[model samples]
Target chain A: MQIMVNGTTHEVDVEEDMPLLWVLRDELGITGPKYGCGIAQCGACTVHVDGVAVRSCQLAAGDVDGEVTTIEGLGTPDALHAVQEAWIEHQVAQCGYCQSGQIMAAASFLETNPEPTDDDIDRAMSANLCRCGTYPRIREAVRSAATKLMEA
Target chain B: MKAKTLAVAALIAATATTWAAGETATTTAETEAPSVSVADGLEAWSRIYEVASHPRCSNCHVGESGIPMWSGPSYGKTRPHGMNIAAGESRIGAEFVTCATCHTRSTQGNTVAHAAPRVDMDWQLAPAQADWFGRTSQEICSQLRDPERNGGRTAQDIAEHLDHDLILHWAWDPGGGREPAPYSLQEHIADVMAWGMAGMPCPNG
Candidate 1:
């Protein structure tokens, strides 16, 4: 099957039932999305498919009919996305194991809700767990990113 | 399939014998054996309660919020579903991230632990009216009989739903160390059919 990831299409041979997480990490070698709970319980494997944040671990590679975007594709090193910039401004990473998923989920949330209240942020980001309990900073960063997006 | 057919045949025979004995005796028997009476329907309901209240079934059959639960034997702590996932009014998360975005419509077995289990149907929470979480067995039984609360489904439709819905079948075969609902799927279906055949009586009724 051919899947477009990070604006590039890659043809890969694998089982249709193989999770998109494995295809990204083991096959195509895009390892931004981590493996936390293989189930959808944890949002550690979050990614964007056609601009919607979803658990990559639960998504099948063959079923992906949308353009895929991982944390790596969010921004270039020189020009970070607004969420990434705010993440750095807030110093959001502690263990950093779940930061990529958090960033991805936030980016998608902000796309629809560029100016979100605390409750909106809570409802949208609640699925992404940060064991370090960086939720306060996550909220701050989302607010900061939202401001930047509004300005842009 | 063959076993189910035989079970249905046996049930018919049992119903016939009860009818031959007359309605009065069957209704007042007070015995545990299957019979053609309101008591039998209530008894079947008790069994249905056991399965419907199990975490595998009740977790997704949430209240008006449309937020599925995460409580069960498998989850050490009973809490809201992880990832703050909400089904919204659609009960499928179509307003935001769709359930099918992660849950596939393929019946492929999910053998690995902690992985998203797959079913051939679109994964979603039960409708609001069918919400069973935190409800008593009597309440659930009453709700099931009400056409307004039960999706306007007839008594026979309830049996067909239990017998045919793959999402419901997933309750019996949920992988990933998750405990399944009480009783085998076949047994649950039989109980549901028997309850419907007995006029879908509730304990309070």
Candidate 2:
């Protein structure tokens, strides 16, 4: 089947039940989305499918119904998305294993809630687990990203 | 099909014996139950109740909490579904991560240990009005007989729904090391039909 990932459409031959994370990491060689947990419990495999955040590890390849966007597609190194810029500004990464998913989730959350409160940010980002305990910085980065998005 | 026919025949014989034994009619004056004795209907309903209240069915039949439960012996301890999952008002988890993200639709049987349960139908929680989780048998019986909370479906309609609904079938044949609901699907359907024919009698009535 043909799937578009990060602005590139590629034909992939795989089993129907294979998770999208496997397709992205194994087939397409896009490892931005980490596989913290194969189950949906961990949001380390979060990505945007038509701008809606979904856990790639649990999403079946055949079930993908829209354009896929990983952290690679979220922004370029030269022109980072507001969430990415905020991450650097606030130093939200501790070990950085979960940073890509955190940024992706934050970007998607800010899209629907551009002016989120602290509680809102906490509730939204709570799904993505960070073992390094970088939540304070993650919250600050989300707040900063919301400000940057508003300014733009 | 044969099992259902035999169960219904047995129910009829039981109803006849109860009537012959001078069983006082248990249904209220307004009850729509036919010739079947209230005693027999309630007996049949007891079986249906077993299946309805089991964790396989009631876990998703939640209330306003919008949180489906993960209970039964398989889960070890009765708790809210992990990961703070909420079905929201949509009942399909549309506002956040859709239930389809994990519970994918599939015709194949569930053999994966500890994987999210899968069925041939779209994954979703029962409507809030039909909430049955942690409810008593009497409450579920009343709700099943009432048209409003039961999706405006009469007892016969409810019986047919139990007969053919794929999700309902999942309750009886749930794989993944989960305990199937009590009694076979055919027996459940027969009991439901017999109960409906008996005017959908509630336990109290």
Candidate 3:
């Protein structure tokens, strides 16, 4: 099957039921999307499928109907996505293991809700779990990201 | 049970003879079959309720909550499905994460332990209108008979839905460590057809 990840289409031989996360990390070696919980419970494997946020860990490779954009594909070193910039400004990362997924989720969320309220940020970001308890900063970053996206 | 079967056979024979005689068919089967009493229909309904109310079936047949449940002996206590999942308005989780994300549609049975269960049909919560979780026998019986609440399906339509719906079949043959619903799928459908034939009598009625 052909899977486009990080702006590059890759032809891969894998089971259809294989999670898109595995296809990204193992098959294509795009490790931006981390696998926290194999189930859709944890948002650590969150990615953008045609600009909509989806848990890649739960999405089967065969079922991927759109182009996938992971944290790596979100922005470049020269020009980071608004969410990435906001993350740095808010100092959202403590351990940084779940940051990529967090950034991806926020980026995707801001696309649809460019002017989200604090409550909206909380509701959306709460989907992704962080053991270090960086939710306060995460919310701040999402708020900041929303502002940046509006300006841009 | 044997007596009921014989009575039903006799009723069928009588009905067949009545039709063959070419006497203008006037009354419905409900009026004609005195031997197949309302008691028999209610008894069959009890069995149908048994399968419908089982956790395997009712867990996903949630009401306005939109939160499917996870129950039976395996889970220790009856509780909502994990991950704070909601089927939302779509009833397929299109708003947040789709049920298909884990419960992939496949003809093959659930093989992995502690993973989401799957059937050939697309995994989804039963319509809010068809909510059966925590309902009484009378409430469910009336709801099933009422065309308004029952998706406007007649008795035959209900029987056909039961026969063709793979998710209902999954209740009886749910692979994995989960306990299957009380009776076989055929038995449940047969009960439904019998109860429907007898005017779908409620316990109190």
Highest DockQ model number: 1
TM-score of chain A of each: 0.98, 0.99, 0.97
lDDT of 2 by residue, B1-205 (tens): 2333222433222222122111222111112334656777888888888888899999999998788999998999999988677777788765544576567666655666677776656689988988899999899999888887888987667755664456777777677788999887657766777787777888888
Give the alpha carbon lDDT tens digit for every residue of B126-173 in model 3: 999888999888888988999999999987688667656667667776
Question: After best superposition, candidate 3 residue B191: deviation in angstroms?
Answer: 2.1
Model 3 agreement with the true structure over A1-152: per-residue lDDT tens digits: 99888788889999987888999999888888898877666778888888777778767787787899999888998999988998899998999888998888788767756787786677566678898999999999889888878887
- DockQ metric, candidate 2: 0.22
Output the worst ten-in-a-row residue range by lDDT, candidate 3 chain A: A119-128
Which candidate, 2 or 3, would have the higher lDDT against the true structure? 2
Displacement of the residue B53 alpha carbon in candidate 2, Å:
1.6
Task: State the lDDT of candidate 1 residue by residue for A3-34, as single tens digits.
Answer: 99999999999998798999999999999999
The superposed Cα distance between candidate 3 and the true structure at residue B175, in angstroms, equals 2.9
- Against the true two-chain complex, what DockQ does each candidate achieve? 0.33, 0.22, 0.15
TM per candidate comes to 0.77, 0.80, 0.77
Q: What is the lDDT of residue B160 in candidate 3?
A: 63
List ranges where model 1 is wrong by over 4 Å: A63-65, A75-82, A88-91, A111-115, A146-152, B1-36, B83-86, B93-106
